[model samples]
Target: MASQAFEEIAETFEFLDDWEDRYRHVIELGQELDALEEEFRVPATKVDGCASQVWLMPAVKGQGADAIFDFRGESDAMIVRGLVAVLQALYSGLTVREVLEVDAGAELGRLGLDEHLSSQRSNGVRSMVERIRRIAQETL
Candidate 1:
């Protein structure tokens, strides 16, 4: 259940014939994200198990399972920041329950990220997803 914004990215990935072009597109997506405020970059929001420093701040609206789930994230590395943006596109605007239900690996697989990313990057992505899932669960 990808969001419309994510679906658009996936479609663009499909149109891009080479991994280089897709990689550039991912970086471009990251550039579109608002800079995460320095105050929110504290340890409380920092995601563990990421090779690159990463922070994710939850922004839930309402309450319980129906609460809307959203987060702002940042990373020291450019590609990792893009990965955060991808995660944002994947999870933003979904309800907490919907966020919990997302098959992130499967959704990202559509973009061939699994094949393209390095082992460390893949682990970082997994860490980000786990953090997001935990946030959604806590919201519920």
Candidate 2:
């Protein structure tokens, strides 16, 4: 289940005439995200498979399957940061159970991100999705 924020991005991507414009939109989205606090950037939060340094701090409210799943993330690379923002839109604010139920690749594919991104970037996205899913699963 894609969030409304993610759907808006998809809609914007559809409205853009070219990949360059869409790329810029993604970068702009990244620029809009709140900066991750330094304390949250430690080794334990770091996502290993990304080419650039990336960290995600998961936050949960309540308990068990109904807990809300939210996370804040940052990346040293601008495009990667944008990807993180995209992930935020895709997954944030869902119940932990809902987060686990999401088909991340399918939802992202609707935006045609799979075709536009480089292999390394694609792998990084997968890594991020996995991390998000793992966090949700553990919370459950």
Candidate 3:
């Protein structure tokens, strides 16, 4: 099932016709996210290929097909942090298979972010998704 968070974000983006307003909303979402603890911000959890320092920690609940993963992530950059929030909204509490199946890039495109973000930022988003998928694959 799609997360309520994802739906809410999409709706908010739709309601905000201006890209500037949407960007502000994304930044606000990042500001509202709970910060990851210092201990969890280790080299092991750090995401590569991002211009800004980013960390992701994953926790699995249940077993087999019933399993759902929860992710906590943080980034030094404001926009990057917002991107992390979006990823969390889309992927957290989803089964490993469901996480893999989600077309995150397409969703991002739908949000009109693909055209708005710099190439480096776009690549960073891809890197984050790759890291999440890798974690899911390893757990499976």
TM-score of each: 0.98, 0.97, 0.95
Candidate 1, number of clashes: 0
Q: Write the per-residue lDDT of candidate 2 for residues 1-140, one digit (tens) a residue.
A: 98889999999998998989989999999999999999899999999898889999998897888998889999999999999999999988899999999999999898788999999999999999999999988997
Evaluate all candidate structures by whole-model CA lDDT and list the values in order.
0.94, 0.92, 0.87
Give the per-residue lDDT digits (tens) of candidate 1, residues 33-66: 8999999999999999999999999999999999
Report the number of the highest-TM-score candidate. 1
- How do the residues 1-140 of candidate 3 rate in per-residue lDDT, one tens digit apiece? 45778878888898899999988888888888899999999999999999999999988787665589788999999989999998899888889888878888887777888988888999999999999989888877
Candidate 2 local lDDT, residue 132? 95
For model 3 the local lDDT of residue 7 reads: 77
- Clashing pairs for model 2 are none
> Which residue pairs come into collision in candidate 1?
none
Q: Where does model 2 exceed 4 Å of error?
A: none
Which run of 10 residues does model 1 get worst, by summed lDDT? 24-33
Candidate 3 has an lDDT of 0.87
Regions more than 4 Å wrong, model 1:
none
Which scores greater on lDDT, model 1 or model 2? Answer: 1
Ranking by lDDT: 1, 2, 3
Score residue 101 of candidate 2 by CA lDDT.
90
lDDT of 1 at 122: 97
